[model samples]
Target: MKPKASPKTDQSTVRQRIVDMAARLFHQQGYNQTGINQLIEEAGVAKASLYQHFKTKDDVLQAYLAQVSQDWFRQVERAIAPLDTPKEKVLALFDLLKSFLESVDFRGCNFQNALVELPPAELNTRQLIRGHKTKMSQVITDLLADADPDLAAQISLLFEGALITSQLYHSVEPVNAARRIVERLL
Candidate 1:
């Protein structure tokens, strides 16, 4: 006999639970360090259910990255919404990064972390990372529409460097320095 299907809401809940647990685990520990069994236990879902929702752990990682991308963009939009002028908004981006670093205890960029942890063979995950970064660069580009086109690229590099440096130092000093450089650039 075939097994009965779960309700739609239950299935959605299970999937979200798994993704949420995976996000936390993958962030707190590197992706490879987290095990499928731990995800099942922490998510409070059956092993079969996890496989039902995600054919592989990589699928779960993809979902986590997607969710993070959406959340990150939303936060950025909200952070810059109240500012006036492109320069102010662009500078505010660094402030937002500083807040984020402190909030996460200087864990650094999730996309960067995933890129470092995931093998190049994981093309889908790498593409997601690239897409998120491209979108972020576009945001800066749009904000600097009146300025030299190349400034956006320079600022993007500075932003990424600051994140990595902040993570290394376990402090927001790098973010502050990046903000100073951005101020000069603007």
Candidate 2:
């Protein structure tokens, strides 16, 4: 005999399914290009179920952005966890970016991509993107607390640049080059 799943658990699972499918679709295709009907179809959930979880398409997008922000930070923290020094951790960030870019086939930053697709009126979505970036900058600042204050800012810029360049060229060479520059800065 199998155990029965609780109502809450079932609902949560369905919600997660929608969000996961939304992330994949939104990332693979532009945000504006992905329709609610497509998300419902791909997620294998009924239209009612999708609406039950997310009131609007923007709500689903907000949820996706929130999830990605948490996931991205966790990945960054894990990647830098083993390093002993601030500089080492900072350099490791670039290495992590290289691996991440390769793993995603140079898809580039999700927030950056979303920003381009979003209209200027999307204040909430824009705020979420800005918050993610601000948190990332804070992480760099924390890592370089004892170094020249400007280094963190500079590294952050390089990191973003590397991501864009890597995506543009469909290669990780830009990430490697960024790592070298970071090494020199450190």
Model 1 misplacement above 4 A: 1-6
Candidate 2 Cα outliers beyond 4 Å, as residue runs: none
Residue-level lDDT of model 2, residues 63-165, one tens digit each, is 9999999999999999999899998898988888898888888888888989999888989999999999999889999999998889999999998899999
lDDT of 1 at 148: 95
lDDT of 1 by residue, 23-110 (tens): 9999999799999999999999999999999999999999999999999999999988999999999998999999999999988898
Residue pair clashes in candidate 1: none
Model 1: residue 110 alpha-carbon error in angstroms: 0.8
Superposed by TM-score, candidate 1 places the C-alpha of residue 171 at a distance from the truth, in angstroms, of: 1.0
Q: Tell me the lDDT of model 2 at 32.
A: 96
Reference-based lDDT, residue 45, model 2? 95
